[model samples]
Target: MTIKIITPEYVVFEGQVDSILLPGKQGEFQIFKNHAAIVSALVNGQVKIYTDSVPEKYSKYFTKENEAKSAYSFAIRSGVLEFNNDKGIILAE
Candidate 1:
């Protein structure tokens, strides 16, 4: 799946990802490849990014924890996230 995180000033991140874990208004949830269409409110919290390999350009904004998961994460302000087909987008304030 592909993901993009955008703010009013700039596009924070854009690349292919294996999964995304978001802090939803109701609770935290993970979205995977080919996830069903969804539109949800997000809370200010951590956003996790998982991929087979880290994109070098965006490495500064993420931290790789364990090799098995190849997970990276960064804090996100309040936002809205939408997913459809193989794409997911986050509109952050």
Candidate 2:
């Protein structure tokens, strides 16, 4: 699945990910490939993206969280998430 994280300034991250963990208003939730469509409000927290690799150009916007190099994280103040048809987008503050 593909995911994009965008803010007012610029696009934070955009890439294919195996799964995503987001901080929802009620609690944290995880989304995997082929999951049902969803739209939710996000709170200030971290967003974790799991992928096989990260392109060098976009690596700067993400923090390496594990030795395997398959997981990365980005921080957001707040955001809205929309996911459908194996794609997800986050519009952040």
Candidate 1 Cα deviation (angstroms), residue 16: 1.2
- Per-residue lDDT over 33-72 for candidate 2, one digit per residue giving the tens place of the 0 to 100 score: 9999999999999998999877887888889887556888
Deviation of model 1 at 19, angstroms: 0.9
Q: Which residues of candidate 1, in runs, are more than 4 Å off?
A: 66-68
Which of the numbered candidates is closest to the native, going by highest TM-score? 2
* Per-model TM values vs. the true structure: 0.87, 0.93
Give the TM-score comparing model 1 with the true structure, all chains together. Answer: 0.87
Per-residue C-alpha lDDT of model 1 across residues 50-69, encoded as one tens digit per residue: 87766677777777766457
Q: Any residue pairs clashing in model 1, and if so which? A: none
Worst 10 residues of 1 by lDDT: 61-70
The TM-score of candidate 2 is 0.93
* All candidates: CA RMSD (Å): 1.7, 1.3
CA lDDT for candidate 1 = 0.85
Task: Give stretches of model 2 more than 4 Å off.
Answer: none
- Please give me the total number of clashing residue pairs in predicted model 1: 0
